[model samples]
Target chain A: MTEIKTETDPSGLVYVIGTEEEGMSWIGKESTPVEEPYAIEIRLIEHFAEGIEDPNPLYWSDEYAQQTRWASRIAPWGVIVLCKEHKVWRPEWMEDSGGQDTFFCSTPLPGNKLLATDYEVECYVPLKPGDNVFINEKIIDIKPKTFSLGEGHHITVENYFRNQNGDLCIKDSRTVFRYR
Target chain B: MQLPEIKDTYYEDVEVGDEIPEISIGPLSHTQFLFIASSHHDWYPGHHDVEYAREQGLPDIFMNATWQHALFQRVLCAWAGPNAIPRRIKYRMGKPIVRFDIVKARGVVTGKRIEKDECLVDLDIWLDKQDVDKVTKGSATVVLPSKG
Candidate 1:
């Protein structure tokens, strides 16, 4: 058992290779826009609202939504957080690194002290159930910085969600402190 | 605990410095976190597996960052009306929101303008910790119809 040793990143091995590079090597990288078609029978947005237990009449009844500016049922803006994900290509390393924990084109910190430094999401066309959103993500910027958590990289990920008809539905930018 | 049902805050009435409506949620349950983990791709074992989390040095299962926005979405639509076309939402994540912690989603109107006969409202939004700190911080923009 003495000869047995655990493998390590000897060169301080960057585990999540191509997707995450040293010093802005990945600055211009863009993922193939992921599109997932939503079927009519599923009421995803409403169910998301229900999951949070929000008692909004607009989410519950089309009758109520029509009374407002919207002439039909509309979803709570944040409900889109739970919308079905637009599929994206995952590097084999990422697939094996446990799961999606905000790695977004940067090196992971030593531990789970990551912080949500900042984020931005915008909507152009109102989202409803059965609406297929095509998501395009771009890596805008990454900077090495110091924070309460320790040393980490600050990264910004911008996303644009376009409906099947091609209208921009929602846009979001999330900044994360991937720290040690 | 709850607000009046679906009251419309029209563009003409809203103003800068006014508080963007908010929703409070929390002390999330294990089952709920489990439900979210199962439904979405947020499959980090640390979120559900106590042993894994302990080995990785976490106290217990914790809520993911996405849920903070869920509360924000509820608060915004509750005030501006669901049809209010949202223009943008940006956020900064802070503390780990775990089970049994109450979080309040709050925001304040930062700006407003009129263009193309539509009124646009800009808000600075956040999810507040039980004390003076914030869990997540951000901004949201929405377009509201004119009273006319």
Candidate 2:
């Protein structure tokens, strides 16, 4: 397997995955685990519920959640990804790099434009308030495909979320169509 | 905000071809989009900047992936009941859900089975824009409590 290298030029950041053979090398290469900046909190959970206008008692009301199996307020299943999103605020010295740089985004391909075409998520445990989360991301697969938009590759990336105790909480995967 | 009554759904009570009550949310406005974007902490330009989206060949700003997933969660869990556990959710994105598009999330029971002493239900789920075009479509697997 070829080791793809990342390079930066005056034009900006450039990641070279090389040929298809080189791109294949990225499969199974996992990134170091990164802990979420903040622990899960009821306020944050309710804020997300409000954003989506979801009135599910499980996400907000402590009394209603207490009656459920969890016996405590829990974050919505969909909010699992949001909990691991890149921190919005960064140090002033840090450059605004658009968003968190992941192997999937930096991997060089024929197409520069990207679109998320598919997603899959499996919840192992309910994300409860006060649980600290850590995430490990890896490239699962890369395949050549032609779409109506243009020719590109279908990249599948999987994200594994775990609690501070190392118990897996959610396994999420997304397939993006990168086309010219 | 008032909490809508969500009936508890049991595995024994569900049957193949039963439709989950659809949830409609849309004619989405800029404020709503910003709220979601901010909450998710997604600073992706295509999700918030109209000019950036146009530069990327999109007509206007659109919902992010996380927001799309949340739409399905809202509908499925509400119908499955509070005790139900969402084991898996998968969907394919079709047309871009841009601003002002009225999107509706829906699901139907496709099958059911018992695994590891847990009752699991399979559902085909989708999101439609204006009750016409499907902007997102896929399937989900959930664990529901049994009456027994």
Candidate 3:
């Protein structure tokens, strides 16, 4: 076992490497817009609501959403949390350490934590039904460290949201791990 | 919605290898997404668009990992009934759970032990997407009131 030391980061770590220098080339670059739009139709949105066991009428009722000044039936917050697109790329060292199968390989902290240390979100505009939205992501920073469990590092990534009308919806800053 | 009744489960009543009832969830609708996005204020477009998802090189708009973790509690609560508190849940990302996707939570009783008045039911749980393999898997330990 490798003896590790904790860095000055708020969360102590046993291992650490900076990802910004290695992976920040794509930062601020917009990905090519998709040719075929990923349709988030009303019916599909309704189905997603039911799947998550969400009971709010605004997400299922157009009339309710319209009354509330929302653009359309809204997507679930959990959907964004579950999304896999533009996720932080794992560093080569981290991947080499465990390869494919491993236990507790990664822990991506929610960007919402940046807004509030306790993991809460700040609402700007509600995504309504039929509202077309786009997501853009970038790796902003990285910090390596050693923890009691062993050696690990933290990676922070930023994401931006834009609606069809090109409105800034949300900005997210999230953190993840690359452990040894 | 009224809370489900708390089922009285005893350590003696549960055994290793017993399977929990399977649950089917979803057809996640746009409105549901809106309500969820608005409530959680997530407002991320990749969550509601496949175009954005493809741009990001993903199969579809994926579910938020953290939100899924939180909602998993509801699934556990439903199965364990009201009295059980979700102690700790950990998961890694798999495939994105999309709209109209029906997911199920199943568990095998891994072990059971008694701690005074508390009957601990150790379960190995999985949140699997219907018609597909498992999306996320983890272990949970719930403390149920014992039948003393």
Residue range A1-180, candidate 1, lDDT tens digits: 533222222112133332224436666566666664343223665666666777777667766666766566665545454555433345665534322222352333232344455766666667666666676777788887776447767777777777778887777777766555
TM-score of each: 0.76, 0.89, 0.48
Per-residue CA lDDT of candidate 3, range A28-59, in tens? 43333221134345665565555567555555
Tens digits of lDDT, candidate 3, B1-148: 4422225455567778988776666776666555555444344565666675565455766666555654555555456643344444445445667777777777777888776655777777777887777677767676655555
What are the clashing pairs of model 2? none
Q: Could you give the DockQ of candidate 1? A: 0.44
lDDT of 1: 0.64
- Return the candidate ranking by DockQ, descending: 2, 1, 3
Regions of model 3 farther than 4 Å from truth: A1-51, A54-180, B1-6, B115-117
lDDT of 2: 0.81
Model 1: per-residue Cα lDDT over B5-101, one tens digit each:
5656789898889986567776677887776665444555656666756654566766666666667777787777655766667776656666667
Interface RMSD after interface superposition, each candidate? 5.2, 3.3, 12.0
Candidates' C-alpha lDDT: 0.64, 0.81, 0.50
TM-score of 3: 0.48
Q: Show model 1 residue runs off by greater than 4 Å.
A: A1-15, A18-23, A37-42, A76-116, A146-151, B1-6, B51-59
Candidate 2 lDDT tens digits, A77-138: 65655555465457999876443566666776655556788999999898899998888889
DockQ each candidate and list the results.
0.44, 0.60, 0.04
Q: If the candidates were sorted by their TM-score against the true structure, best first, what order would they fall in?
A: 2, 1, 3
In angstroms, the error of model 2 at B133 is: 3.0
Least accurate 10 contiguous residues by lDDT in model 3 chain B: B1-10
